[model samples]
Target: MIEEPPTTTQRSAEVERRRAGELARPLTRPAGPIAVYDTVTDGMTGWQFLRTGRWLAYTAAAILFAIICLFLANWQFDRGQQASADNAVVAANFSAEPVPIELALPTLGSYDASQNWQRVSVTGVYLANEELVVRNRSNSGTNGFEVVTPLQLSDGSVFLVDRGWVQPSPTDALNPDSIPRPTSGTVSVVVQLRPSEAPLGTGSTTGNQIQSITLPRIQQTTGGDLYTGAYGLLNSQAPAAEAGLTNTQTSMPVEDVGTHISYMVQWLFFALLGFFALGLAARKVHRELNSDDPEERERASARMRKRARKPFTDEELEDEEIDGFLPLTRWGLSSGTGTGSVAGKTVGPTAAPRVVSPAAPRMALKQDDDAGDREQGD
Candidate 1:
């Protein structure tokens, strides 16, 4: 007579006992292409893992990436430092009490970059005929020209002054509709110090229109003792220019430290993420190789099979040896050999034992068996 199949409850109880037995037994070196288990069994150390060529390549790539990130971080840090220095200079000079031009300059054509925007008082008469228009200037978003008048001091040296910006004539964009004349007599003017700009080499000066406040170039026309190093942005005059002109208001320098710090931090985190990803991948391989679960072991085996299809490198060959060997008992019904028995009970070729909790009561087991048998009959 044909023997009845074992009930689901009985199959489950058998699987639990087998799982417990497998867990209790000491792991032995597995044979075949599976090298990871063999390596673990042989007590391979962490240093040995790093010594592998694949790991060495990964480490080198991470180091290179980290070095690039650090370089960019340093560049941003330097830019932030420079911006801070510029802001400091503006803050110290923009509103300080005015000093005499003689004291501030001491020598003609000598100026300090750090003295930018410093307030200076000077008494001089405007040489209106020698005045020039600085082309391509803007004020309140209107494209215009700045009126640069030569202020001849009592000592006979001339200092250039940028009176203010004025809109070009609606009829003639090349010139102003009208230029307001500076106050005629000895005029006391308060002005901010500014370094003279470099000459724009060719086609920069034409007739009375100039492209920049380059003093030496302007001195070519005016021809006297000229302050070549610096000029002035007019603040106020005792007897200001006739009603048509307004003082040019210079914008204050911003003191904000931009997003460089944030970008620096993001790059550092990216460098760290590369190492984290490597660690996670290594852990996944370790778990898959050592797992007692047959499905997990099959997945690891599948990886090895895929790798085998490629021309093997030394590292790949080592990995292949680690993942190829699996125990017949662990494969159970899936192995197709049908040789292993679980808890002294024979399992069929197509039937894999189901795992159940060890704490299941005998009464519950009997109830489940009855239910399964009825279902099988149905």
Candidate 2:
């Protein structure tokens, strides 16, 4: 009696069984620069693997990455701390009862960071001719200049007062269109204290224009005992100026401790994540190479293989179709083979045929052969 050639269904079933068996087989050592292996199988214990050159290199890389992350986190933490300190100062001084300027600044040009935004009262005469405009000032997002006028106090001392901001001329961007003159003669002003800005050392100061509210720079022209440590943002003027410009005082510093805290936390998490990932990868390598149970070893190998496998591309699929090969479908069967019986049931072609590369099976067979040879030699 002669047996008929196995039907397409039987051939497919046999292919599947062989494929499953191949996947279930333990993997031999892979050949590559970054290949992972079982420590015990390679005649090394867990501790031995940790001491290997490759693992040490991996550990060093993780340490370097963690160090960078930690540095950034530390920088952000410092920034957050500084922001909190600034908010505290603003909260303490922004709305406090007005104090005499003499009390706030006991000596000439004496001011403290703690006194920032402190309301102060000063009686002096406004010297309009000696007024200067601070260049590159911004008011409500519009580029402008701040009008800084000298206030001569009772004791022959001078205090700089930033009256307000005025827009530059429409034609000439460098100069103000018109500076609203401060209240002429003696006036009592209520203002918020602010640190004197440093000289910019750039920009043309030819006319009554200066790059910053630097007292030393302004003292050269005014010639008197000047308050060099700090100036004031005009809050209100007794017998207010006939015409006033837009106030240039900045809004209160926000109390919120922004995203720095969150970012710092995230960086810390990332540092830990890097170590966790390395440990997980090491554990997977140990199971794949050192596990005594063949099934466990096979499963680990299968998982690694699946992760390493690249998905088929459209161009590759087209090339297979051009080569006249039946492409494998999702069900691991030939597509569009026309009325083929599947598991004792006739099925219609629903998709175009796809090609199944022979390279994978060939590689599996080669690995198995190599393992057998190694075992025999042992």
TM-score: which candidate is best? 2
**Candidate 2, residue 265: how far the Cα is off, in Å:** 1.6
Task: Report clashes for each candidate as comma-separated counts.
Answer: 8, 3
TM-score, model 1 to reference: 0.60
Q: Give the TM-score of candidate 2.
A: 0.69
lDDT of 2: 0.70
lDDT of 1 by residue, 47-119 (tens): 3555567778888888888888888878878777877888899899999999999999988778998998999
The lDDT, on a scale of 0 to 1, for candidate 1 is 0.69
Clashing pairs in 1: 33-321, 34-321, 34-322, 34-323, 34-324, 35-321, 35-322, 36-322
Candidate 1 residue runs with Cα over 4 Å from true position: 1-55, 199-205, 220-222, 266-378
